[model samples]
Target: MSENLNPAELQKTCLYDRHVALQAKMSPFAGFMMPIQYDSITVEHNAVRQKVGMFDVSHMGEVFVEGPEAEKFVNWIFTNEIRGFEPGKVLYGMMCYPDGGVVDDLLVYREFAPDHFLLVVNAANIDKDFAWIEEHAKGFDCTVRNESPVWGQIAVQGPESEKVLADVLGLPEAANLGFYTFYDTEYKGKRMIVSRTGYTGEDGFELYTSIDGTVELWDRLIAAGVQPCGLGCRDTLRFEAGLPLYGDELSAEISPVMAGLGMFCKFDKDFIGKEALLAQKGGEIARKLVGIEIEDKAIPRAGYPVELEDGTEVGIVTTGYHSISLDKSICFALVDKAYAALDTPLSIRIRKKVFPGKVVKKRFYQTNYKK
Candidate 1:
């Protein structure tokens, strides 16, 4: 667990006050004072899976790249192919170091023109990511600007997300968006960006608007009976859906291929870390990320040692939980390739005792993403 930081030093989002009023469990995460949960993690987790729920994701970072060479610059830095990306299209990929270690996973939104692109990154990596991109923009004939402070984001997710936005928020554009797509629209004369994207692995939409607009929209959604969810459930939801968390599933030492996310890496074009990732993809990798299911009720957690029956340590657990949706002790672990095969016997060291387990598919619950 990360040490608790001083609240006075933590940044607050536009919805900070609202979360406080709701008596949420507040914590310092990614340099921001944010809500971890409103009611209980289970309740909030189920709310989004079964009905409509809203999350104050204003802490996320946004950067813009605009110029005649925007496409080239983006393709150069990103692992995904974006050569023919049309406006309103969103691509999920990662930035990597020369050694193929992940810089950060992000979403790239091509807005109305070929020369304009929006990069939404994890809040914790805002400063580092912005600096990295800016430093690399030296000769790209483009400008890089961190627009995180100027924008507030809200995600309305789950099965009833579309209906909630259309009826409560009065945004008909929400219903028209396909998965990984977005559009610019106006609400009460204020410009907003609505995208069919979310972290919860449900059919949902993320709304990016001004700070004031976020406050107003949050209030309206609350009055319309949308459950206000927090970050605690968000982690569990994403984990169950097999979505990777930046610091956990991926990191500066963990490449995309090692984390089982190689499909997003386009090999046809040159990007930072292309050579190393290509070598990793074509040859042998020492360790690979895999899912482990503990037979006992004891929950595995991050940093827990994964061992074989002979008590030989093989890997470490990256993320784990007593899955809220599946009601099982499951986790994602970075283990030796020999131990990553399905049905391979393994043991998770939970406290003093070692629990029996086996490797399984990382997706504990099937996602309901509307494509």
Candidate 2:
């Protein structure tokens, strides 16, 4: 689903000029003028898969949580268990409605400071997620601040990302960051964070700094020959790795459990959506997300219908592509639980023709993420 945008009132990120100078294909995305691609999508996609690439993700939203009740409050609202979480650790989880529908999937970083956290959320759901967090925090003694406008972020992704961050950016501390860990430092006296995290399945890091620092860092990476990537490849890479996009695989109506992401949701801990999720667990799951591999060369796309052999529709494609890395047509579809089993035969109605397919593992490509 696309973000609501007037097109006439698109916003710009901190590195808008840099993208323009690079002659990127700019388009309105999530209320911002984002780069769809600097080079060909294939080239950029491969750059990240093989070597390194960077994205201007300054449009992503960041929210700060602080107070005496921050731990308890975050734990209550989040599906992941982070009670008495250690500083520098990052956890991926979703905030779910009481009915078990997802509010938003986000990365929550327990800051080094006591009772503080940083939540990095999707751009389209920034305001909505912040409001949801505030509304659920009525009785809690924590303060929530939307720091989206203050931070500039970039993701350095790929196999060589550690060397790039060390040699190019000269942040050797980043090389020592374990997966899902972060360390705070100063960049030109502004608070900068280097987190060993990324949307792409490859081991990488997302650096958050001030707007000016972001621009400077972007220039540095560009000058050092790091491929300036765009959202086009970002989507392909994440899709290849079977990561969920908020409005797609996971949404307000698609619970994490239905998306086969129950592992990230902690049931032992009291959470906003735990009871409903447990109820869903006890009952029949009507639908579930699954992967489909088409036999034909025709690509599957979002909104395409999935059907049984007789053309009886069961579900819709959430995201699909002719995978650049795997050289196969793969897609994630939310379908009836009866047909969600691996190897269950299915078909995708691409346009006029229905192509034969079968359910497979959602992870179409094996990831090379470093531990």
TM-score on alpha carbons, each prediction: 0.98, 0.98
Give the residue spans of candidate 2 off by over 4 A. Answer: none
Give the residue spans of candidate 1 off by over 4 A.
Answer: 1-4
- Per-candidate RMSD, Å: 1.1, 1.0
Tens-digit lDDT string for candidate 2 (160-244): 9999999999998788888999999988789999999999889999999999999999999999999999999999999999999
Judged by whole-model lDDT over C-alpha atoms, candidate 2 comes out at 0.93
Q: Indicate the residue-level lDDT of 13 in model 2.
A: 95
Please give, for residues 1-371, the per-residue lDDT of candidate 1 as tens digits.
Answer: 36349877789999999999999999999999999999999998999999989999999999999999888999999999998878889999999999999999999999996699999999999999999999998899999999899899999999999999889988866787889999998765777999999999899999999999999999999999899999999999999999999999999888999999999999999999999999999865789999999998899999999999999999999999999888899999999998989999999999999999999998889999887
lDDT of 1: 0.93
Candidate models: Cα lDDT each: 0.93, 0.93
